[model samples]
Target chain A: MSKGNATKLLGAATLGLMVAALFMVFVYAPAEATQGDVQRIFYFHVPLAWVAFAAFAITAVAGLFYLWLGYPVFDQLAYAAAEAGVVFCTLVLVTGSLWARPIWGTWWTWDSRLTSTFILWLLYVGYLALRAALADGEQGARMGAVFGLVAAADVPVVVVSVRLWRTIHPAVLVTREGSHGLADARMVATLLVSMVAVTAVFGWLLALRVATLRAEARLRGLAAELLALERASEEN
Target chain B: MRAMAAVLLKDVVVELRGPMTTTALATVSLLVLVVLVFAFGPVWGQSEPTAAAGALWVALVVSGTLGGGRVVAVERERRCIDALVLSPLDRGGLFVAKSAAAFVFILVAEGFSLIVALLFFNLAADAALARTAAVLALGAVGFAGLVTLVGAVGGRAKGRDFLVPLLAVPLYVPALIAGVKASADALGGARLGEIALWLKVLLSCDAIFVAAGLLLFEQVVAGSE
Candidate 1:
C-alpha cells in the first residue's frame, strides 16, 4: 500500500507487540531463582541489543548501496538507520548498566560482551559526529558511507579482540556463567516476543525518520531550483 | 605497480627532502610518552611492562592520527589530488601507495616512541625489545591502512583534522587491543608462541583495513566537478 498506511500499520503492530511483550515480561515470565526481579530486564535488554545490532547492519548495507548506486534514498536510509541504531544502542547500554548494578553489584564491568558493546556505541557516535561535521553534500554522503562500512567491518574484529583482551586480563567481577540458560519456556516465549516487538518498534521509527529526511531533501532541492529560476529570470 | 611505486616514491622523496611530517610525528609521540610517564610514574611498581606497552601504543595512535592525514592533506594543499585523480593510475593502486607511505611514517614514529619508552620505562634493550618492534610493525600496517583511508575520507569535509581521529579511533580499537596485549606480553618476557593469537588478530585486522581501503578509497576521494 502507500507509505503512510505502511507506517500506520507498523505503528499499530509495534504498539500491540510492545504491550504484549511488556505483559509477558512482567506477568508471564517467571523470575530467576538467584537474581530475582532484576533478571526480568533480560527480556528487554537482549531484544534492545539485538535491534541495535540489526539497525547498524542495516545502516552498513544502506551505505554500501548508496556508495554503489549513488542513490539519495540509500543515503537517507543510512543516515536514518544510523540515528536509530545509536538510540537503541544507548538504551541497550543503559539497560545493561541498570541490570548490572543490581545483578553484578557494579554498574559496569570490562567483560567481553560489555566492552565490545561500548565500542560499538562509540563507533555509532563517531559516525554521527562525522556526519554532523560535514554539511549535506555528495562528499559528506560518500564520507559517511565509507565510515559506516569501515565501522561495520570492524565489529567482528572488535568483538574478537575485546574478548581476547578480557580473557587475558583477569576480570574484576565474576560474570554469570552461561548467562542465558532459560530453563522456563515462558521466558523463551517472552524473549522471542520482546525481540519481535523491539524490531517492530525500530521499523516504525526508521520509517518515520526516513520519511522526514526525504521531505527535507525535497525541500532543499526545491529551494535550489527556485533560486536558479530567479537567477535566470534576472539575467533575462 | 609502476604508478604505485611512483606515488610512493614521490611521497618518500618529499618527506625525505624536508622531513617535517616525520619530525612532527616523532615529536608528538615523544611528548605523549613524556605525558604518560608523568601520569603513570607514581605507579611504576604496579605494572611496569604493561604500563610501558600501554604508553607506547597510546603515543603511536595519537601520533599516527596526526601523521596519517598529512598523506592526503598535503596533496590537497598542493591541489595535487585532482591531478592524481585525473591521472591514468588505478585508484586501488593509489590507495596502496598512500597507505604504504603512511606505514613508513608511522613505523618511523613508532620506532622513536619505542626508544623513548625504553628510556622512560627503563626496560632492558634485549630480545623483548625486538619482539615489541615486530608487534609495532604489524600494528602499524593495519593502522596505516585505516588512518590513510580515513584521512582521505575526511579530507573533503570541514574540520577534517578532527574527523580523522573521530572516525579512525573506534575503527582502530581491535588493533589497539591486539597491539597493546601483544606488546605487553612481549615486554613482560613472554614468548612469541604465547601471544600468537593476538598477533594473528593484528594480522587479520591489517588485512581487513588494507582490503577495505582498496575497495572504498575510490569512492571516498572521487573528485567532483
Candidate 2:
C-alpha cells in the first residue's frame, strides 16, 4: 500500500529473480556445442544492452514531457534515467569486451551493433556532461531535453550507417559460424528468466535514483522558502 | 521565408564584413589535413583512397565543430541572441537561417579542404573529384544543421569552445561514417550509382538533423538560465 512497502517488495523480488537467474544460467542451461562457457555471458550482455536502450528511451521521453509541460519532476526523471542507463551501458560494453576477446579474438571491433552501442554510450555521456556544465535551472533542463530528443533521433541512423560501413568493408576476423540463436528450450527459458531479472534490477535502480533526485529538489525548494520567510520576518 | 532570408542576409553581411567564421573554418580544416597527412604517413598518391577520404572528413568535423559553433556564438557577443529571441522572426526561421549560413560557410571551407586534399593526397581532378565534392556538400548540409542547433546551447555555456565539439561529435558519427565511405568510393572512381546507399544515409541524417533542429531550437533558446 505504502511507497516504502512497494520498494521493499521490489527489492525482495529483484533478489529472488537474480538468484533464480544465476542458477538457471549456470545449472539449468546447457553449454553451447561450440563456444562453451564464454557464450554464457550473452545472458547478461544481451539483457544489459536491452535495459540500457530502454533506459535511454525513458530519458528521452521524460525529457519530452519536461519540455512540453515545463515541470522539474520530468527533468529529474530524465537525469535519473540517464544515470542508470549509463551504468547499464558500461556493463554492456565490458561484458561485450570480455566475450569478444575470447571469441572474436579482439578486445573491440567496429561491428555495427558494437559501434552503435559505443556511440550511444558516448552520446549519453555527452548528455550527462552537458547537464553538469550548465547552470542548474530551467535553462539547463531545456537544453538537456533538446539534446536528448536529438540524440534519440540520431541513434537509428547511427545503427544503419555503421552497418553499411562495416558491411562495405567486412572485417577479416569475423569467424561467426552461424546466427546467435538458442536452439534449446532450456536455454530460451534461462534467457527469459535472465531478462526478467535484469529488467527488475533496472526498474528498482531507476526508482531509487528518481526518488533521491526528487527528494533533493524538494529540499532545495524548502530551503529557498525558508530563506524567504527569514528575510520577511527580519524586516517585520 | 522573407524573415528567414533577412536573418540569413544579416549573418552573411556580418560574416563578409569580418570573415571570421569562414576564415577560422578554412584555416582549421587545412591544419587538420596537414596533421592527418603526418599521422597517416604522407605517402601522397601511394596511400589508399580510404585514407585520404577519412583524413578529409576528420578535417571537416574538427574544423566544423570549431567554426560552426561560432555561427551562433557570434550572436552572443553583445547579447544579440536575446534580441533575436525577442524579435518578430519565427524561431524555426531563425534556426533555418543560422543553419543555412553554417552550410555555406562549411561548403566554402570544404572546397578549400578538398583542393588541398587532392594535392596532399595526390588525387586526380576529374569526374571523381566532382563526385567527391558532391558527396562532401551533402555531408556538409547535415553537419551544418547539427552544429547550428547545438551551437545555440554549446555557445552559452562556460568553456563553450570545448563544449561544442563534446556535444556534437558523438551525434555526428553516423554522418562521419557515411561521408567518409561515400567520398572514398567517389575517389576510387566508383560511379555515383555505386555509392547510393551511403548517400542515402547522408540524406537521412541531413533530414533528421534539420527536422530536429527546427523543432527543438525554440526550447534551446527560449530563455536565459
Question: Which one is best on lDDT?
Answer: 1
Model 1, span B1-225: residue lDDT tens: 898999999999999999989999999999999998888799789699999999999999999998877898899888899888887888899899999999999988988998888888889999998999999999999999999898888877778888889889889999999999999999999999999999999999999999999999888778632
- Residue by residue across B33-98, what tens digits does model 2's lDDT show? 888878766455554688889888998999999999887888888788888888788899899999
Q: Which runs of model 1 end up more than 4 angstroms from their true locations?
A: none
Candidate 2 global lDDT: 0.89
Model 1: per-residue lDDT, tens digit, A59-169? 899999998899999999999999999999999999999988977888988899899999999998988888888878677788889989989889999999988888878
- Candidate 2 at residue A46, lDDT? 89
Instruction: Estimate the lDDT of model 1.
Output: 0.90
Question: Which residue pairs show collisions in model 1?
Answer: none
TM-score of chain B of 2: 0.95
User: Among all windows of ten consecutive residues in candidate 2 chain B, which has the lowest summed lDDT?
Assistant: B39-48
In the order shown, the candidates' DockQ scores are 0.76, 0.80
Each candidate structure's TM-score, on Cα atoms with residue i matched to residue i, is 0.95, 0.95
